[model samples]
Target: MSESGGTFDLVILGAGSGGYAAAIRASELGKSVALIEKDKLGGTCLHYGCIPTKALLHAGEVADNARESETFGVQASLQGIDMQGVHKYKDKVVGGLHRGLTGLLKSHGITIVEGEGRLTGTDEVTVNGAVYKGANILLATGSKSRTLPGLELDGEKIISSYEALRLDRVPESVIVLGGGVIGVEFASVWRSFGAEVTIVEALPHLVPVEEESSSKLLERAFRKRGIKYELGTPYESVKTTDSGVSLTLKGGKTVEAELLLVAVGRGPVSEGLGFEEAGIRMERGFVQVDENLHTGVGNIYAVGDLIPTLQLAHVGFAEGIFVAEHIAGLNPVNIDYDGVPRVTYSEPEVASVGITSKIAAERGIETTEFVYNLGGNGKSQILQTQGAVKVIAAKDGPVLGVHMVGSRVGELITESQLIYNWEALPSEVAQLIHPHPTQSEALGEAHMALAGKPLHVHD
Candidate 1:
């Protein structure tokens, strides 16, 4: 391999959210950086994962609103979904964001290397027969869609999220193979687009990682929307049929659909990139990092989905900033994983922050919990949405967790994130006023009830 003959202060592999964030922050802190990416600069979140999927979800929302316009006395009707037009709209949104991100990176003056990079030494990454050395190397390679042991993605009858986003037409029927965020979001989108959708989850509840109450609420909403789901049943096998595909569950129950989407989870892209050979510890393909995200090998570090963290894009962004500051000797604080907000942007959204009641019980912490129904909130009434906000707190301590299920509750999660991260007491939050006729008041009322005061709630 030929030598590039120059060493940067920081070299980041994978120009996804984490890698680009580190590059920008390190450049701002007056450090020379090299960002190597084999794919688009904005990475999965930009091109295929977060941005495109959310765009499709928004289109689905528009379609739903049009179909139900008479409920608001608007007297409107939704025409059939045009797949080509929907894809065009989604592509436009992605294109604009991609251009903006590219310009931003250029303005930061960080070197962008276009190739697949491999860790060759403690401080060297080889790409295209040229070795680029760095004072510190960061492994920011992100993640990809995961499949079950016997299942394989063919980009046709059986597919992953990547192919789902690029489909030219909506299937007549679909069987989504998981019930996590990705599964539910796609299920919601397809049902809204007028398709027969069935979700088969081995877990007991949809979005099992969320609070049980939130999961039950979402399940209720999905039932009302006519989204079919088979819970607690593991699929034993799948076979492609002439019309589409057939899936068989453990108990011999069979499900047939025009397509099957595998949305179980995402696994880190850490294989054959020379991470293990460089002496970096790994667990199940995920890089093992210390509390500070250090690999304990030279000045090497790993961030984003590459490490076994939250895997959310925002988490990746935060970790990237923290690592850049740490490398700059700014001594940044480590992130509290619980404080990161999680949102599932389905028709009736689900959002939460901080520890769940189950997690609290697992940690042997005593807690007090309260649930405030949206039925009591004027804004929810105005929107004609049914849901509730639940808050969990220490018996005499601060707010431990906040969970909500309703339309657009994801927009309210930032406040809950702040409250959780600040460890604010229920009384403290209750003392503050939320605007009248707003869903945010649901959270406020929940806090008030938890603080021994109830206004519109009957005891």
Candidate 2:
């Protein structure tokens, strides 16, 4: 097809989680769809963010487990880490997902267009100077790693998470800035992979967005692993010399390392996309959309990090599917941002959905919280990690939140979010059994407490 392409029902920009899901849904609903991307078929999450990071974490876990195998009554030992082999494994995981996406698009009849997409007008998208008009447009270009001032990333000594994920050789020593989820997750992976890693976060605790107690557990766990850090105080600046990076801290403390990973955070990738000329409303850099995920332009919608909603890949997927259904006249159920689950997949993984205990207090919902210790869980003892599950509920109403920390607590977010978002009552959740002798029993106990009957704990 020429640059002057045929009309489509939907023209989606950036085929990552949101864009691809939207295209498939639109096509299944009998809409002619075109998806444009300048890079990989799957955006950062599939290529760099989620899939590859998890692969690295798995490898690191295996390495660490092998080293500590004696405690598990096994004599497992590791030969050295094969850095190239690590990369090979990560790439293989990403490749499988890439192929899966390709097949899904082909079967759904969504046309894939290769090139950068720009909204030249309200309903017009130009890819490689080819104009394609759509009845509607979706902008899901996603985001990029954001760096602090005076800390320019060269993808080397001063690197970004992008480089951290593709390291061919584990650095002998590394300094990480930003103790958020990304920073700590990489810290966990590298610590397990046998890197001398130190995390420097400006917050008083690691994973600042999580519950204070949860952050404390993660900090204690990392310390147990001997991962060092100068946290709570910001690093004033990073000076790179012939040898390595020298980070100057607030208290005039200085630390040096061969490499630095900046996981400060991510910013929306919306520049040069022509949103200004298209007349779509925007707040800050994110596109402004309504409850239906519709942009100000009648036939235009926005999702993913491009919109001012949550920047999570799952949120993007949900928003994409929601918009497609609204366009197809499905009138699907609206999502409560409060109900969406958020997880940090580090050791003693932090997960939560709905209002935090702190937020519940501020919002004044007359809230009460139930705490169930992972110390009592048989599975937690087996894994040698102890944490807690916190359930927040209205004094006389439904569940308001669920927060968890323990080995592999990320999986709990799914069930927690369901209870919180569905406005499920304590009685409702108490009715469900979470299986026997599993870590999930912690949640069942929390629900039981809120339901006026206690299980595994005396009230």
lDDT by residue (79-170, candidate 2, tens digit) is 88998999988899899989998888888887888888899988889988888889988889999999998889998899998988878887
Alpha carbon lDDT of residue 438, candidate 1?
87
Report the C-alpha lDDT of model 1 over 391-442, residue by residue, as the tens digit. Answer: 9999999999999999999999999998999999999999999999889999
**Over 4 Å off in model 1, which ranges?**
1-5
Best-performing candidate as measured by lDDT: 1
TM-score, cand. 1: 0.98
Name the lDDT value of residue 328 in candidate 2: 88
Weakest ten-residue segment in model 1 by summed lDDT: 1-10
TM-scores, each model vs. reference: 0.98, 0.97
